[model samples]
Target: MQQLALFIRKEFIHVLRDRRTLLILFGMPVMQILIFGFALSNEVKNARLVVVDHGRDLATAALIARLDASRYFEVEQVALSPPALEATFRRGEVKVAVVFPARFYEQWQHGRDVAVQVIADASDPNTATTLTQYVSAIVYDHATEQREAQALPYGLRVETRMLYNPQLEGAPNYVPGVMALVLMLVCVMMTAVSIVREKETGTLEVLLVSPFRPVLVIVAKAVPYLILSLVNVGTILVLSTTVLHVPVQGNVLLLLAESILFITTCLALGIFISVQTSSQQVAMLISLMGMLLPTILFSGFMFPIENMPVPLQVIAHAVPAKWYYIIVKAIMIKGLGIAAVWKETLVLAGMTAGWLFISVKRFNIRLA
Candidate 1:
């Protein structure tokens, strides 16, 4: 008990003394949350658009008014011809070009669907999609209102269903990704670098030469990190659920279990990396560039794998961060129980086992 307390105290002191690292560990996440919530989001507004209204009649005027009135489209240009509209898009002056066919109102009133062509830069797919939706929504709303006034049902019914988050609150998705990143950084990177630091400083040799068993030494080194990682998990959970108002509908126990499993896997990975590298700097480099980038890119945090190119999507499957992100999303956002996340749990277990086995093999090779 005394030894354990001493070890805990030493670890806490080490953590606290590194003020820069401590600040990054605690502060970066808040910064990332703010950035993701405000700067980067699927919900777009005030997009600059060009209107090429060939009809120039009451109906086209009304549609233009609707488009401008709604917050989505900002009428930036009123180009007269297709060539001018194309030039506006080429110069990136507008995201969308709204073209109303000649005699559009006359055709609609004479039993024809009003054909409004929305030309968008497909190179920027997200912007194109949003702009198209904005235009379609305005046109649909106007058409529906006109039909309803004459006691007729609108021809279109847009049934939009948001799968995971109905309200699309930013935190539900970001919080889980943040937690996974934190675990990867604090748990795995810290463990690997800390172990490598000991090796570089020759303390590892001292420990091995001591009477303490190798496994016990490893456990002692990892125990402090385990506690720190758990504290971080608690801190994030509290902030996300309480301040961000993201609900945890799943069993808290199940979430914690998955979190623990993820932490263990990361810690084991760190140990494996530490065994591979000879210096703290090398470990840190590997952790950041090699591990961190893949964790963020491949983890479905920024881009949906379903939409990614086939080869990139295939590569994402091997990244442990991907599985951890899925588990966190399932448990946190979807309120899935253990049964729902068992496959993810198994994958994490497998990764942990693989890393541990590698570490053991390396340790034995070094001993020999």
Candidate 2:
């Protein structure tokens, strides 16, 4: 029993010495609990709602008040109409818009049929549907209250318009997210693992001693991966358009350019990881498992980022995949041009430059 206890203590001491093992054992569970607790929620609340109240009457005021008072909506009145509203939606300024027709209260008071238009940005079809449903229920309840108060039978019709994706298809929502995930995981993992493999086999050390600067050699080694990742982007795009029937609604060349920038950013990230880690296992683990959750949770594709806690929402901005996902959705789903996505594009460019700068600064020619 004493010998067995000694063996157990030795194994525990071995595990305690490995920072990586300790992190996996204790750090990951706490991280998962916090992230899953705060980030994984489907209930939408405090959604920005744009209202064009053409009626401008007492009844319309009451309805708008109710909507704003509801926990699900935060209303902002705007003087926007159909064709002009497209720009607002493209900018992601509002999730849903309520357009009260002119003389809305008068028509309802006279017992005439009145229609209220609810225009939703359906880039994320599920949210769009849920928001529309909320609006419809509110409208119905308002109509019922009005009728009971005045002792008159009149109704308010909700004409829902789901823009971008009229059919409420899932493909339009998930394809861009999948594109971001695929590019991030594939590029980061491949670049990190390939370079780390060279280091494990002693090839990287041999090349490090060569005449060329170590940074330049690292760039040379990673360039092929950048090309291959671009090819993967093209293949994914083709499959998305043909097999999935999610068309590229914006400039194809521009999309390709954006994809190249994102792939470069991911490659830079992978290079930074390879420089920091000596083992292929560590590189792969960091590239795959470390990046996977951030890309999914923060990317704003699976869950609405605005609904999360303020800190998590702030953290979402740091995830490169979030910017890429936003860019792809703007270009592909909304048919937006560079003007709409320039900020996100600049962010990705800055991230790429930052990663390259960090990787070059940290790379040491001396082998550890």
Model 1 ranges off by over 4 Å: 54-58, 76-79, 153-158, 167-172, 238-246, 306-315, 364-368
Task: Give me the candidate number with maximum TM-score.
Answer: 1
Residues 1-368 of candidate 2 have per-residue lDDT tens digits of 45344533544464457686446434443343334323544457799999998999988899999999988899999887677788899999889999999998889889887899999989999789999988988988888878889888534444567899885556677778777887787778767876787788897687778665676666665666566567666766776677667899999888899999998999899999998998988998999898899998999888899999999999999999999999999999999999999999999999999999998999887888
TM-score of 2: 0.61
For model 1, residues 133-167, the per-residue Cα lDDT tens digits are: 77887787788788777675455567667887875
**Candidate 2 runs further than 4 Å off:** 1-154
Clashes of each: 0, 0
Clashing pairs in 2: none
Cα TM-score of candidate 1: 0.85
Q: Number of clashing pairs, model 2?
A: 0
List TM-score per model, in order: 0.85, 0.61
